[model samples]
Target: MTRSVYVTGIGRSDGRQVVELGVMELLTRQVDRVGVFRPLVHDEPDELYDLLRSRYRLTQPASSVFGMGYEEAAALQAEQGTDELISRLVDRYHQVSDAYEAVLVLGTDFADTGLPAELALNARLANEFGAAVLPVVAARDQAPEAVVAEVRNAHDAYASLGADLIAMVANRVADPEAAAAVRGLAERLPEPVFVLPEEPALAAPTVAQVKEATAAKILLGDHAGLSRDVRNLVFGGAHLPVFLPALTEGCLVVTPGDRSDLLIGALAAHSAGSPAIAGVLLTLDERPDDQTLALAARLAPGTPVLVVPEGSMPTADALLSLEGKLTAATPRKAEIALGLFETHVDAAQLSAQLSVERSERVTPMMFEHELVERSRAARRHIVLPEGTEERVLRAAEVLLRRNICDLTLLGDPAVIRKRAAELSIGLDLPAGDETPADPLSGPGGATARIVDPQTSPLRERFAEVYAALRAHKGVTYELAHDVVSDVSYFGTLMVNEGLADGMVSGAVHSTAATVRPAFEIIRTRPDASIVSSVFFMCLADRVLVYGDCAVVPDPGAEQLADIAIQSATTAARFGVEPRVAMLSYSTGTSGSGADVDKVRRATELVRERRPDLLTEGPIQYDAAVEPSVAATKLPGSAVAGQATVLVFPDLNTGNNTYKAVQRSAGAIAVGPVLQGLRKPVNDLSRGALVQDIVNTVAITAVQAQDAFPHGSGG
Candidate 1:
């Protein structure tokens, strides 16, 4: 099932739209893009959906969002029965859910529409949309006891209708001690229940909203100040001395424009930044002189000064009824809404409930998240050679924060520490855990450690080991001693010596610089004939594996078959189903070339070795990926389309194709993951971004889990 949540209000004034925006914030944090669906809306534009599209940068069209207006839905239900209405709603809902990694479904609102049983309708729609129901109950203006009953009833009502209840929320609760009284409902509910006190800022209107409501003219305003939230409205009937105390942060001062003295005092306070006001609302069509108005504009360059023809009393009534709506113009409220959610709701619990059984398609985000989760489950120690690199330090902080794995960073300790402090990365050992001395270190168990390769006590031991490994190649003891102090060599020796389970480097060095030590010291597994690399190409919707893109130069038919098998194992291990495609310039027997024969022979070898693997060979790139292209090029081939593992004939074609797709199609190529090694030793691109480094580290840690299942000492 698609991961989706439907947030619906049980009745009017629930103010649950904030919950939807908050959930969108969470979903976008998890995935790159999130789809929003509104089943039934009014004929007018959906202010909330517009806000979602603008703020979240959603690309869902109106055809998916405004499926059917309330009147149209009501007419359909009356004419064709509710079943037909539900069927069409489900169709429109799937249009969005299928396109996005995660979906947020906005349920039907019980506004002025004449539709009956809106709660039941929302429940049915949520079930049909395969969404977990998160019903919001408004507790404002009701007694604590009544609010408790309402929350319990809402949960039971949704659960009774076979709706998957995600969580229960009581929004805008009214009791003075509602925070204390919310315990009753919280304890009774089986799932997590949240209670949010009415926030005045979220319930207040912005300067732009007030201007629209009162039809006020902008005397002094800019685009920015017009978006400020009016936390409170103050009418300037008091003297200047008493009125200043009534002002609060984000307050909008209302006064007769003729009161130049009060207006000047307010602008002076605003200029001093004592209590920053939202904006000023001038009433009664009164005027400050030209000089004073110009002074007001200069005092606060972007602060708004709106003038209306109505009296202060009427303006107060209009402003009091208007509440803040989530829009692109109001980002402060979005922050506040997200804060409320992050503070009150258990994000981990919610995410666990939102998780569904894995489907056939593996998204890039899902693959990355699974890597982090899987690595963290069985922690390992992975060594990073470039400790002083800025991207490595940043990714180290993230990996430690996520508890992904303990890290060993190799460099000069003093330089690494100075740079890390400059970058504000905290790597201090916890209490009772001794920070390492200058040369050697503690085990650095669940965090990170900095090792100075030149000064470390293990350098001589590593020198002896390297001299033994490379003695046949005419390397002497003194030369091996100098070579062992290099960071990449030291880090790889750490992996070989069972000090760390895996290694990741190459951020500030060449790939050969990082991998040469691994090839020399660690060597390949006994069963493997050659060491090759595969890149996990993260397309927008799916993740595909492209093999030998970095390691091999001109592999023969046997080496190409080994690369395909290694790539299929890597893909399947990382949650991608590997339908291997031995890619060539030709499609089956369509063209004849030396490269085509090599790929054809490789495909035969793969079938002979692993008959269980679904594979096709001598296929073009389009035929390997696109179903329509496959239908024309190779009609009956099983792996013609939907191939997750694509093995190229040689390195030049695979590397160039991967780069072209990465640049043109905006795919993330996460490796060059070195395979067939006795222990996992991966390399990074010198130009890798911080996220790329993080992803690569996660991949190395997961591989380390397979190498060192019982912890660091393999």
Candidate 2:
């Protein structure tokens, strides 16, 4: 039978979706194909189901995800009895279960179901479906003893109905002590209970929600900005000096559109990072002039400026009724929800209950998931020299929100802040002592360390160090001082001086400009002869490492061998098994040329040095990756067809191959991750996207973890 878990809530507003999402994440991590089945859903579009489909990259058709709408189920139960209703639902459930290794069954909501005994109905369905039941109880606004009693009662109710109870959860507990007390009380029960405290951000209204409630026109802002949470509401009617102090981070400002003074003042405060406002709500149906709108756009480019048809009082009333939801559009909330669930829930116990096994094949989603989780496990500080770039700043926001790594952004601090404000991204700036605040504190608490190389106190120290390191190579204090002012040089120095664990640069800069500083300051590792780079080409089914793709132009035989070794080591360092393939225009002894000879020599050197490595060489591209071609050319070679690490003969072949595969094959190229460095410093392409920056930074952090296993310089 397919393994399954049924998530049911005891009452409404229990925040059970968190548990559902969390369980789905665990299921996907363990199995390649996990299906979702909602026994009963509303007639409208299901936000949670859409979120699951998009986030998990589920291939199942939407029509198959749910058994039936609530109205249809209600009518069937009223006319044909509950057993007939359940029998049809069970058939629908089996449709999903038959296709997937595991299935997640979302129980019907208790609100307006018109059922006389909803909880009993859920228990019966779970038992019929052969699914282990995990019940969620809303503990919000309840006393500690009451919360404990509710959990016990829910467990008893499910168990008495012959449902296989796996675990229980107490969600939305307002009082921390009460949450703790409930957790303690849960031990005496039949199963484990996970208690999650109230998170205001999850319940706060999103900008999009506000727009929907008030019928507001979106004057400015992109989808990203519209998804921001409105944690608080502020009415703006006073003068600039008086209203500025009232601003709070993630608050929506309510004022008339004619009050450009208040609007501009709020934007200025957001720019200064006093408190990052969520958006502006223009009341009374007033609209800003074109010139004013243009100014607002420049001041806060993506910040939502909304115009409503009602006055401030009515707008406030509408906002009060709005609540944030976990939807496809609000991915940030999903991250926050997942983080909360992972932090509090006992994943080990849950996995054991579900009997989930680890997946053998690593998909692209799995690769990205592992990278983020591993980087978070061994935290490291990574510096970015292109801090003022919009994509970099946006990627920084994602990194900070995900709690992936500590970041030090090198540029003019003012410029970085201004750019972040314009982008409407909340950055956690360093405190007075140059240390990041606790990332989990709240908005603006996970800021990156912003450093201006020109004004920083470490400039003199870095200049002196640079001068000492290069004194014999025509360096002086004046030249070192001038060079240290450059963000790339300063960032590289930060890595060399143990201030940062690693550095990722080259966005909006050339590769030479980015890595030149690293070569000058950080240099290559003592055990390695040369520096090379690799791109983790994330194909549809697996991740392949491509090396010498961005650096080492026209490398000789020795350099080629070093590249192969570095690429293999990198492949193993990541989760990929090292099966090296040295590529040329020839396969086996089929061709003769300088290029083929170089590759043949490199393969020989690899065999001589690392006899334990699995390697094949002097191979064409077709023979390296295609199993049919490999069987025809070299049938018995272990690494011929299943090559995980491909080493190009030179830059021309390596770079072109990577790009062609990336564009034509729709692959996600995660690097140009530089290897063999004394410290980890990776370069990015100038056209890298936000996700590209995020992936490179994560790779850099993982490299740092490998470099300093004892948590050095984090």
Candidate 3:
């Protein structure tokens, strides 16, 4: 039987979407194939449905997600009675249930449904679907006793209707006494009751929402700025001194565009980190002069500046009507929501109650999650040379928030902080008056160490070490000293000298600029013969390892074997079983060429060296991946169609093939992760995004864990 949970609410404004999202998160963590079904949806597309599909990476089509439109369901219920409506919905529910291991049934919203017994309808649907019910009751603006009464009533209503009750949730409780009252009720009720307090940020309107509501023109700001929440509204009508006091954190300043004094003052305050504002909304559509606008851009590079035609009063009225929705675009709010849910609710107990079975196959999301979890288990410090890059700083914020790894950002401390401020990122630096034991301690107890290569005390030590390591290569002390000041060399030395566990660079530098330092300093492992690279190509269903993609432009038979062996080791280390496939233009001796012969030789070498590893060689791409093609081309081969690690004959083929598959098939290529290094030093693409940086950092941290089994310091 399919295990299903029905998330139903007693009334409108209950904020049940949070509970639904939280449940989905738990379900995804448990099962790989989780489906969502909305019994009755509006004619317009569902925002929450889109959010779940995007965030959870659901493959189910949108038409299959809901039973029917609310209007259609209402008409059916009216014409043929409620029995027929329930019958149709039950059939639709069964379709979703049969397809998935678990189904999350979203109940009807009580708002404007034109139905007199919406709660009873939800209970009936839950009963018909044979699903466990989790009911949410809104306690907003209610007293403690009223809130308690509402919870009891909601539970009884569902129970009386013969619904299979799993638990109860009291959402949006504002009063402290009400919150306490709900907690007390949890003990009295038969089922567990989770009480969540009102979070203003969840309800706060984003800059994009405000712009949409007022039809405002975006004069400045990027998508990142537009997603910022407007927690407060400050009218900029007073003098600079007086208006400055009203500037609160995440406040949206509303003033005329001609008020350059107020605009510049707010920008300056935001740059100084004195309660950084969300944005500045200019009324009357009056924009500042070009010079003033340029100055504002310099002050806060990504801060949103919106221009509206309405006056302040009308704009405030429009803003008051806006509310935040949990959509795919508002990812930060989703994070905040999940954090709140995890903090307040006992997720472990809830998951246990759901009884969702774990999946055996590893999905792309599961693989990514495992990477983060593994890295977090043994936290390692990773040094990033491109610290001042906007994407790097943003990635640092995500890394610190998730507690995945400690970071050492190599650059000028002041310049990094200034750039971070311009990007509206919080570095969590210590107070100016206080000095900490570790100079790298950031806000919220995360360590984000910043070091200037030129001024760091370790510069001379690094120079001496570099000169000693490269003495055979004719490197002089003066040349080593000059090179030590470079961020890449400095970062590599940190890993070599045991200051950091690993290093990830090359966001803005060339591949050579990033890897040359590691080659000179860290070198290759004792067991490895040649340095190589592999990219973890994350396809829709699974992840495959592609090797020799970035390094080693041309590998002879010996180098090709070394690359295959190294890639197989990397794949196995990262939870991918190694079924090595030596790819070529020919398959099973049907065609002969230099490339095919090289691949065949490499395959022979791998078999001779590691007989325990499953490998096939001189196979075409289609035969290596597709079972049907394998049956025709190379039947009875052990690793023909099931190869997890593909070894390209040379760099050109590997690089071009990985990129073609990535762009054409919508796959995420994680690397260019350099293998065979004595210490882990991975390089990022010059166009890496924030998540890319985060994933690379996580990968580097995991590699560091392998490098140092017993502790960080080698």
Q: Which residue pairs overlap in candidate 2's backbone?
A: 428-447, 429-447
Worst 10 residues of 3 by lDDT: 429-438
Residues 105-126, candidate 1, lDDT per residue (tens digit)? Answer: 8987788877888889998999
lDDT against true structure, model 2? 0.86
Q: In model 2, where is the ten-residue run with the lowest total lDDT?
A: 435-444
Kindly list the per-residue Cα lDDT of model 2 for residues 602-703, writing each as its tens digit. 999999999999999999888988899999999999988889999999999899999999999988899899998999999898888877888999989999
Global lDDT for candidate 3? 0.86
TM-scores, one per candidate = 0.62, 0.92, 0.87
Query: What tens-digit string does per-residue lDDT give for candidate 3 at 1-714?
Result: 689999999889899999999899878776778999999988876989989998888999887899988788889989999999999999998989999999999998898887669999999999998899999999989999999999999999999999989889999899999999889988887888998888776899899989989999999898878877787899999999999998987889999888999999998998887867899999998999999999999998889999999999999999987888899887656755765675577777888789878787666776777787688778888888888887888788667756678888877776776666444454564333211125565432447778778888788889999999999989988999999999999999989999899999988999999999999899999988888999999898888999999989999998999999999988888878889899999898888877788889989999999899999998888889888999999899998888889999899999999999989998888978999999999988887777678888999999999989888652
What are the per-model numbers of colliding residue pairs? 0, 2, 1
RMSD of each: 10.5, 3.0, 3.7
Q: Candidates' lDDT values, in order? A: 0.82, 0.86, 0.86
Could you tell me the lDDT of residue 134 within candidate 3? 94
Model 1 TM-score, all chains together:
0.62
